[model samples]
Target: AARIIVIQKRAAGKKWGKIMVQWHPLLTTSIPVEQPKGQGIKDLWEDIRLPGEGYYFREQRFGNPGQTSMKLTERVIIAFSNPDDVILDPFLGSGTTAVACKRLNRHYIGFEISPEYCKIAKARLLAEKTLWD
Candidate 1:
């Protein structure tokens, strides 16, 4: 299994100014257990399987509870880009783009809306050990 470090915090007080942090591996990627090809063209996605074993993790994302993590977004970036390549995500929900880039060996910049989500995104990126090394 591949390990990922997780950092969590709670917004405190009425202003939510105080935050405490804890670090650990909240999740790990297991070796893909199965292979399946769902409908339509597979796009540029190779490691991401569609509605089966390899695809099972898609649902863990922020908006799509059953879809997958922004981590998959990292895999896509890695497949298409080189280290230090500039990758951008216009709607950077949950900072998935930045987090994934940290893991996939790329340089990325993104924009996200929610302040809380930004915290999570930043935490995710900061916790990552650069895949480049």
Candidate 2:
């Protein structure tokens, strides 16, 4: 069963939304089998708040303009993948996705175009790794 989750965000006086598609891929056979019973994620999520300018703001501390919520990323990772699954993140930004993947025991391949952001991501990833060690 595939599900599409829509996340709406309003920042900098502009309204934008992101769509997350979740589906189980059949790696062995073409025939689809019954998926394991589990709680379903709602199509619309409104609880997670975006990071903003505040004294306590931490998600965007790396200065990534497009940074997202860590809770939101972890929820998506938990809903769509299992332990040891490989996740590809084209735009790593501050490495939120990779950090979440590490916390969830999933492997991740992240790419960041900016050298500064890459350093930030590596630092974050290392911090996350140290927590588990």
- Among the numbered candidates, top lDDT falls to 2
Question: Model 2 clash pairs?
Answer: none
lDDT of 1 by residue, 43-130 (tens): 2333333333222342445542332356455544644466777888877766767777776667777876778777777776777775
TM-score of every candidate relative to the true structure:
0.49, 0.67
Computed on alpha carbons, the lDDT of every model, listed in order, comes to: 0.52, 0.68
lDDT of 2: 0.68
Using TM-score as the measure, the top candidate is: 2
Q: Which ten residues in a row have the lowest lDDT in candidate 2?
A: 23-32
Angstrom error at residue 74, model 1? 2.8
Q: lDDT by residue for model 2 over 1-133, one digit each (tens)?
A: 4445555443433334744332212121122222358445555666654443332245446787677678878867776677888989999998999999999899999988999999999988887753549
- Measured over all alpha carbons after superposition, the RMSD of each candidate to the real structure, in angstroms, is 15.0, 7.5
Clashes of 1: 6
